[model samples]
Target: MKKLPHKFQIPLTVAIMLPIMLTAMPAVMLYSTLPKGAALFEPWLDTVTRMVPFALPTLLVIAGSIRFVVTKWLVQPAPSL
Candidate 1:
């Protein structure tokens, strides 16, 4: 098997993140559709609501930082012939 390229390492990580983004939609929809407004604070639905807003931005920031750093420093400059 061909060893993965160093440049592919970061991109592979970013690509793995795509499925998590896809799952968030259904997760949010399920949260909204559930009749949790009348329920107390300890339910699983409440956890989803509280956690997603707090966590999503943090995730975005982390991923963005990784992308910025890799693009800025890790990628090899084109070799001048």
Candidate 2:
């Protein structure tokens, strides 16, 4: 399989990860936070709306930082022939 180009990688990763995280995180948190028999729709939507703006840039920055550090310092070069 072909790898995505470097230019496309962060955006693609965010696009995929964001929706999954956004949907799953709030549902789990609300399930625990909301009282039994309480409605979830309004709270869930509210959480999503409130969280997305913060989460996107945070996730993007984290991913980019990790990629930079790993490629810069952690990954070793291929052995010479």
Candidate 3:
């Protein structure tokens, strides 16, 4: 398979990882906090369905802002010998 350009790397990574993290984190949290043997499947499915639309854009904005800040303000100068 052909590799994508360097510029696509971060965005592609975020796209792939964010959904997995979002879904998995919620499942872990809900399972731990909810009563044992409580119905899990329906609530998890509903939460994921309702949460994705709002969470995706909000997280994208946050990720973009953090990327901008790190690139803009976190650059290091060449060290002198």
Candidate 4:
């Protein structure tokens, strides 16, 4: 696939990453918190519901911050020699 511009990459990454992380985090957390052999569907649904509102903004901020940090600190300057 063709690559995206840096300006387009941040939002694209956030969009792709947020759903996977959001789902996986809550699933793992709920699994650990819930008793063994207990029902997971209801709890997972509830957790996802509660988490969605907060997760979106948090993920966006995180994605933006990472982009900024990587661009500023990691992307090396061209060699002078």
Per-candidate clashes come to 0, 0, 0, 0
Worst 10 residues of 2 by lDDT: 9-18
Q: Any residue pairs clashing in model 4, and if so which?
A: none
Better of 1 and 2 by TM-score: 2
Measured against the true structure, the TM-scores of the candidates, in listed sequence, are: 0.43, 0.74, 0.70, 0.62
Over 11-69, each residue of candidate 2 has an lDDT whose tens digit, in order, gives: 79778987898888999999999999999999999999999899878977988899899
Error in Å for residue 43 of model 4? 0.1
Q: Give a tens-digit lDDT track for model 4, residues 1-81.
A: 987777687568767887898888889988999999999889998999999998778866986898689879999865689
lDDT of candidates 1 onward, in order: 0.69, 0.88, 0.85, 0.85
Residue 16, candidate 2: C-alpha displacement in angstroms: 3.4
Ranking by lDDT: 2, 3, 4, 1
What would the per-residue lDDT of candidate 1 be over residues 1-81, giving only the tens digit for each residue? Answer: 889978798679767875566556556666676775644334545656666786768878997998789879999766889
Judging by lDDT, tell me the better candidate of 1 and 3.
3
TM-score sort, best first = 2, 3, 4, 1
* Most TM-score-accurate candidate: 2
Worst 10 residues of 1 by lDDT: 36-45
Alpha-carbon runs more than 4 Å astray in model 3: 76-81
Off by over 4 Å in 4: 58-81
